[model samples]
Target: MMGRTVLVTGGSSGIGRAVAARFAADGADVVITGRRVDTVAPAAEALGVRGLACDATSPGQVAALAGELGGSLDVLVNAAGGLPAAPAAGTPPLEALAQEWLSSVSGNVLTAVLTTTAVRDRLAPGGAVISVGSIGAERRGGSYGAAKAALAAWNVSLAAALGPQDVTCNVISSGYVAGTGFFGDGMTEERHRALVEETLLKRPGTPDDIAQTILFLASPGARHITGQTIHVNGGAFTTR
Candidate 1:
């Protein structure tokens, strides 16, 4: 990883931060991005990596990010995403639903799509494109889950397109990762216990768990593995 260049979006905290830390530790040139300068700047400084503030969904900002790279990239991690904001009180039901669904798709799916597109040409032959998905896509994930499901579907085509260049693309579908501020005020003690019980491992997943999986996918050993959705959940959801 000495000469490799890696980019991670939404890397200010949580799983993205963990991924940046891992690659930086291995001596890779790592750059992290978040929407806010306040968050991105400190996280980058603390992790000893470059930080760029860019809203991945915006084409203009993404293009700027690409221009800044001005060279090749070895890894791109689409780790920036989350649930949509709650609608204002008394907002029309249909309008609220529309906003929620649209935001969900944009935040989870388009972020990856736009960011990857911006850096696609910059990705070297041995590079890997990895996106963070969620278990919500399987259960009662609602709009958020549906967006994640869409992300997996998109990865297949992306892998095919990038395969000829020796660039592997995949999605890491995570489940019940703790300490991510993902659940926010919605998570409860009872719910947490139930989630852990549902997993065969009887434990919650963590940022490092997802980070490690991304590292493996970007390594030489996983060169043959692409265009597949890799579930990192702790046996909470089974695939047939």
Candidate 2:
């Protein structure tokens, strides 16, 4: 990856940060983005990579980020997404529900779609576009899960479109990865244990676990793989 240019959205922390770190370690020209400058700057400086503040869900911001790239991108990791904030208090229940659902889809699905669209032309042939998906999409994930499921559905179309150009697109559907602040402080001991127990590995999934998988997808070895939702859930969710 010495000559590669990789862009990781939401790379200031968690799995995105780990992915950026891995690419930097391998000598890729890495650029990371966060919604806030304060977080993006320090993270980029600490990782010895370029940092930009871009809201992945905003078309204008994402377009500007593409312009700043200046060169073709080799790998794009769409890791900018999370659970939406709760709706304001005193709002009507129906309105609050609508707000939460919309926010969930925007943060998770639109973030990936808008960013990828903005940089689609900047991707060189053979470049890879990888997005972080979730097992929640498979079960009782509610609106957030529905958004992730939509992301995977969208990836299939993207892969078909980009396949002719020799660019690859895929989703990494992870299960219960720790250290991502995914559940915030809501993860109780019993809940954590239950999640791990569901996995065949009987252990927690780490950021490195997902990052290593993303690295492989971006590598030459995974060149033939595209339009697929590869599960990295320690067997917590089985396909067959």
Candidate 3:
């Protein structure tokens, strides 16, 4: 990855931050974007990376991000997404459903689609795209799972479109990532235990687990792999 340029969205925290740092440590010129400049800027500086304040859901911001780091992109990681605030207890079924579904789709599917479309041309040959996905899509994922499922579908079309350019696209479906703010304040000890129990490994996943997979996909070792979703779930979910 020496001298290569990579971009990771949502680099202010969690898996995004870990992935950005990992890439920077590998000698790649890393660029990170997030909605909050204050948090993301400090993070970028700490890692000796460039920080861009861009909302992945905004087309204009995405275009600007592409232009700013355009023409030399070797990898793009769409890690800027998550569930919004949960609905109030006892809220109407329609109202609660609407909010979660919208938030999930906007944060997950739309963000990746807009970012990928904005930078498709700037992506270099041998480049790769790695989007953060979820194991939720397999269970009763609700709106979040629905959005993640859509992301996988989009990846197939993206891979086909970019195949001619030698830019492979794939999704990394993560499960039970520990040390991340994925659950916000609702992750209770009992819930945590239940999550661990669901996994075959009987342990939670770390950001490094997902980051290493991203690195592998971007490396020459995975040059032929594309249009597929790789699971990093610690055996929480399996496909026979």
Residue lDDT tens for model 2, 155-223: 999999989989999999999988877788899999999999999999988999999999999999999
Model 2 global lDDT (CA atoms, 0 to 1):
0.93
Task: State the lDDT of candidate 1 residue by residue for 1-240, as single tens digits.
Answer: 687999999999999999999999988999999999999999999999999999998999999999997889999999999999899999999999999999999999999999999999899999999999999999999999999999999999999999999999999999999998888899999999999999999999999999999999999999999999999999999897
TM-score for each of the candidates: 0.98, 0.98, 0.95
Top candidate, metric lDDT: 1
Residue pairs clashing, model 3: none
Positional deviation of residue 78's Cα in model 3 after best superposition, in angstroms: 0.5
> What is candidate 3's CA lDDT for residue 41?
87
lDDT of 3 by residue, 50-167 (tens): 9999999889888888888856789999999998658899989999989888889999999999998988888999999999999988887888898999999999999999999999
Clashing pairs in 2: none
Badly placed stretches (over 4 Å) of model 3 are: 87-93
Write down the TM-score for model 1.
Answer: 0.98
Number of colliding residue pairs in each model: 0, 0, 0
RMSD of each: 0.7, 0.8, 1.6
Instruction: Give candidate 1's whole-model lDDT.
Output: 0.95
Off by over 4 Å in 1: none
